[model samples]
Target: MIVAACVKLVDLRPGVDRLTGAVTPSTTLGCSAADRAAVELALQLADSWSAESVVVCCGPDRADPVLREFAAAGVDRLVRIDATGAPDSADVAGLLATTLAGLGADVVVCGDHSLDRGSGSVPAFVAGALGAAQALGLVEVGTEGPGTLRATRRLDGGRRERLVVDAPSVVSVEGSVAELRRASLAATLRAGDVPVEVVAAPGLVVPPTVTTRPWVPPTRVQPPPQGTAALERVVELTGAMVERTPPRTVELPPDRAAALIVEQLRAWGYLEAVPSEPATDG
Candidate 1:
């Protein structure tokens, strides 16, 4: 069994400085807490199943430090998809999904969201690319058997849903589950030697767009109102012509009020117009 964790290095702020209007050549990048939890969960699953644990990320060389940290902690393999940065989530997801498909990943884990582009859509995109089942935004992850993983999803109104995900599935976890464990000094030193497998990324596929005229409502043709007097035309144009029954206030005996309500209900189609029993002379 192979378990792969999808990790990302996110931008700390906008590239352009707002005050100076100068291009901020250097942008800070780091792993999100949710990504840390994702790696930890992958480690747990890999350890439990005695499967190979792999961490894959798409970023420039600056991501090496964070990748090494994942290695030191316990990942068996580190994969860096060749990319400086993705223009959008679609590109990143494509790169990661292709890599995982080649890896023949039986289980794919991802963070609920990233620090940048927090739509939490990469997992869904990856799953769609691989044609695999996806269970996202899970708070609890575990295994009920050798081939299926059990999870709990947190929902609105303090609601929770339990689900079982089988192998060849994609799962996303929230950051609140557990904090990532620290790597030991010895492990860190050993990780320095671990090789990061770099994979060439596919070209980004931007959506096809065509520039055209700005939108404007089409002119609608309407027949002239019959015998258009200025007053009638004004009323018609302003929509002051009324058709619905006007509201009425009625005071009646209890029995009569009840009958009136029933009659109105019938008129409004709320009640069936059942036929009254035929009156017979005794």
Candidate 2:
């Protein structure tokens, strides 16, 4: 089995101030901790099934570090996608799908979400584009043969659900397997000696949707949430829970809270007032 892992390059640290007419301050997007963990798990599972190779797919601008890490962590190949520094999710997804197709991979893997967008939609979109089944938010994946893959997905309310799907499918791992392994001195020295050939796809165009906006905001660090702040948080939480009820607190002076509650309930389609019946139809 040929298993491929897809990762996005993400900004390690965003800038405090933005420069005029430059690439967006944010750059270098990649797998989150959860994503990394999932990749590791997927690799182990593939290894169990005697996978032919494990490939790490990433963009040219920001893929070096991840590729180096994958090389050190025992990946057979690093598939490079010629992505610009600020390509959006759609572009990345499309590029990834194309790259996997070219690689003749049997299974594709990805982090559940990118650090930048956090939408977690690209993997499914890529799967759909490739005409493959998707098993997302997976914690465990095992394969019986080249054609059959079984995965344990994380479901709502902390439950695990098992799914069986055919290969050439996309699976997004939900968490990091381990800290991205730091490069050893030997690995770093050897990486320079190793040849990395980037397969560049010509004339791949990704169009923008919304207009780009300029202006930047200042950064401020808030105080820790403890002491008086903790008490205030408890009070705020209690107040919010209280607000959810149609019946108001008894402590408030007669009818104000009740009236507000009634107004809210009516607006929310929960209550309607009925007129009293006229006496003797007068």
Candidate 3:
């Protein structure tokens, strides 16, 4: 089995000056959190299945160091697509799809969302371009059988769902699901010498289907209160300063505690009805 993991280098340090609201580049550059999660998942799956793993990235020449970090993390191959200027998310997906097709990858992994844009559209777009089955927000991945893979997805309110998809599928992983392993000194040194195959961006044979709207900040209006309203405001402020109550704790058996938690969650409208089990005739 062959897995291709896509990653993006980002500036994680403080980028915005709080007082001036001016943006600046970070002192250090590293893989985006979501991308690191995807890479870690790919590496884990590759190790468990003894499969070949490749790390793919696209950016300016400055991103070479970030790609090397993936090599140090134990990917069999590192590929860098040399792309300059800011491309739309669709174009980036197109480039990645084309590269993965050339690599003949059986599985493609990517972050659920980018740190910079947070658009959360590239993975789906790449799957569409490759005509591959897609599983988004995956927390865990494992091989089910030959040419088949299982993905465990995280849902809101701590729910999880499992899905199985055929080979040549695309999966986008959530950052909080996994932690990346640290690279050893020897691996880091070896990575410095590894060749990074750079390629030109693929031609935009197909135009992007999505268009972004102009951003407009919301406007807020504040009307001053007058007369007795000021006196009422002071009274209301004083009333709001009530003492807080600490939460009560309860002890119960594990099973009973779980049941009670589930019950309360359902009562609070945080959980839907339990799915009915399939009926079987004896």
Candidate 4:
């Protein structure tokens, strides 16, 4: 089986200054130790299924840097899509589907969520585009036959579900399921000369509903301290649980705040009062 791993290269430490919300570019934006561990586990899983070739794909902007990193991490070919596009979920999904269509790939795998866009749409969308079955949050991938694949998916609340599907399937792997592997010095040298195929964006059309913006919010000063301990105690007691606290105190308007408080209370089963009956229209 030929397995392809889709990897997203993103700035590791994103966000303007926590204080000023300024934008800065740094090399630390690549994959982390945990991500490397996950990739390693994924490679091992693919090997277990007798995958003859494993290709890692990334966007043009991230190609060189990611290729170097993956090369050092023991990955042979880093498939770099040289087209300059928005890298939107749907657009990238289409690009990947087109690339995988002729590769005779039996199974495709991608990270459950990318750091840049945690939309969780790419894998499934790619599967749909390729007319393949897809499994999300997969922890383990196994094989059933020459053209069949089995995936073990991680579910919420600490459970797992196993699904077996025919060839040409997509599997999105959870970061916690497998550790991405780190490349050795020898592997890096060998991977440097590995042939890379540059593919165009295929003029795909992505939906216009999504917008990319740098998240910048003006810094706000903390509220003035009141000397009265009793007042602080009252406010604390009246406040909801700490875990449910929302950041950006001013972001929630009055109506939204009321709705959220009531919703949280209902979710926690703390609301004991019953509403009055509505009057019939005359």
Top candidate on lDDT is 1
Tens-digit lDDT track for model 3 on 1-282?
Answer: 888898876666746655456566655667667889889888987887788999888777778878888889898888888775457778888899999999888888898877777777888988999999999988877778655778898899999999998978999988976778899999999999888888788564444335344455766684543337877766555656457555667799999999998987897777997878999999
- Residue ranges of candidate 1 with Cα displaced over 4 Å: 13-16, 20-28, 205-282
Task: List, residue by residue over 1-282, the lDDT tens digit for candidate 2.
Answer: 677777766666665434543443455445587667655655665677677545555466456765666666656676676655456666667777887777777777778887867888888988987888888987776676765778888888999999998887888877643444455778766765454447775666645534344776766795553436777777665565445536545565668878877877887877976576778954
Candidate with better TM-score, 1 vs 4:
1
* Candidate 4: Cα lDDT at 6: 74
Query: For each candidate, what is the lDDT?
Result: 0.85, 0.68, 0.81, 0.66
lDDT of 4 by residue, 205-233 (tens): 54443434557666868666454797775
lDDT score, candidate 4, position 81: 67
lDDT of 3: 0.81
Worst 10 residues of 4 by lDDT: 29-38
Identify the runs in model 2 with alpha carbons over 4 angstroms from their true place: 18-30, 56-58, 145-147, 176-188, 206-282
| TM-score for all models, in order of appearance | 0.69, 0.65, 0.69, 0.66
RMSD of 1: 15.8
